[model samples]
Target: MKVGLYFGTFNPIHTGHLIIANHMAEYSGLDQIWMVVTPHNPLKKKSTLLEDHHRLQMVFLATEDYPKLKPSDVEFRLPQPNYTVNTLAHLQEKFPTHEFSLIMGEDNLNSLHKWKNYDVLLQNHHIYVYPRISTDKLNPEFENHPKIHMIDAPVVEISSTFIRNGVKEGKNVQPLLPHKVWQYIEHNLFYKK
Candidate 1:
């Protein structure tokens, strides 16, 4: 089986996230797109993030209806400030029979060289990059790489930051979130200021 790891904090899984996952699964030639909920992204601040378990649950709620999309808590048990290389290595070791690829936005491609062991990652796995608004074109070094597959997945402008800010202002973000996920967030009063 081939899987595309869609890694994110998913402070609250919203419709945009689901749409991208669906697009990747349908067009990326991958059997599954796993939403790997990172406990802590090394490059991101942890202050604005919701509790790990709460974020994980929100992802579960958002992806429940999609058969090809799965919510993964693989990073929860790993060390804090989870690194992509480490996670991929662990996953490959644990599931040797399965092939793993990475699903990310073109924006991330610009910073690929900064990631730990990025060269190794590029060599070992396929990378599916979806277009993002305002993102520059892929760097020349990786523009025509065989392991890099550029995809034209639908790009939604909505982001978790947008949802969080709206929720903090006591605005309804139901339209931006999955039905069950929004209900859970409202009931739990998450992101409420």
Candidate 2:
């Protein structure tokens, strides 16, 4: 099986995420797209994040209807500040029958050189890049890499940060998130200042 891993905190999984995953599975060669719930992203600040479990639950709620999209808790058991290369290595070891590909936005691509062990990641793994505003393509470090595939999906600028801010300001997030997820967020009062 060919699985595309779309790793993120997913503090509250939104419609934009679902749309992108659906598009990838429908159009791309990937058999599955796992929305890997990162316990903690090394590159991001932790102060604004909700509990990891809550984030994972939101991801579960948002993606439950899509068979091709899975909410992965792989990073929950791994060491803190999860690194892409480390998770990929562990996933490959555990699921040797499957081929795992990295799914990321163009913004991440521009900063590919800064990721931990990025060299190994580019050399060994396949990457699927989706366009994001204000971000350029991957630099020459991956220029010769045959495994990289670029995709153009509809860019919805809705982010977890925006959702959180909306909730905090008591704004309606019904349009941004799935119904169940929005209910969960409101019930728990997550991100409310």
Candidate 3:
């Protein structure tokens, strides 16, 4: 199967995330879109991110209704602060038959050079880049790269940080999140200081 790995912290999975994932799953050649919940580094325990499992649960709640979108916790078992290349290698070892690709936004594509072992990642896997409301300049090298496919997807600007801040300030951020995910966040009183 052709799978697209969409990595994110997913602190509270929001509607914008679903729109992009669903777009990739339905319009692109990908057979499945896995919202890989990026686990928090144990070394950085005091970080602002929610617990890894909680974020993963939010992803599960958000994606449960979509057949093509699924949640993954592959990073949770890996060593802390793992790189994308390492995850790709591990996934390759775990699922030898499946063709795995990356699903990222335009902003991420611009900073791809800073990633560890990025050369290996570009050579081994394809990248599906979706539009983002980024003011950052694009890297010239990947402008016409064969491994990169620029998807004409909608530009979603809603961010998890925005939702978190809104919730903390007692604003109505419910519309930004998936119904079940919002319920889960509300029930847990997450981000409410």
- Whole-structure CA lDDT of model 1: 0.90
TM-score of every prediction relative to native: 0.95, 0.92, 0.97
Once superposed on the true structure, which residue ranges of model 2 sit more than 4 Å away at CA?
41-46, 135-138
The model with the greater TM-score, 1 or 3, is 3
- The RMSD of every model to the true structure, in order and in angstroms, is 1.6, 2.0, 1.0
Cα RMSD for candidate 3? 1.0
Best lDDT among the predictions, by candidate number:
3
- TM for candidate 1 is 0.95
Candidate 2 residue 186 Cα shift, in angstroms, is 1.0
Residue 125 displacement in candidate 1 (angstroms): 0.2
Q: Per-residue lDDT tens digits of candidate 2, residues 1-193?
A: 9999998878778998998898899888899999998786566777778888899889899988899999999988898666889999999999999999999988888788899999899888899987788746458766656888888788878898888888888888898899999999888978998
Best by TM-score: 3
Whole-model lDDT, model 2: 0.87
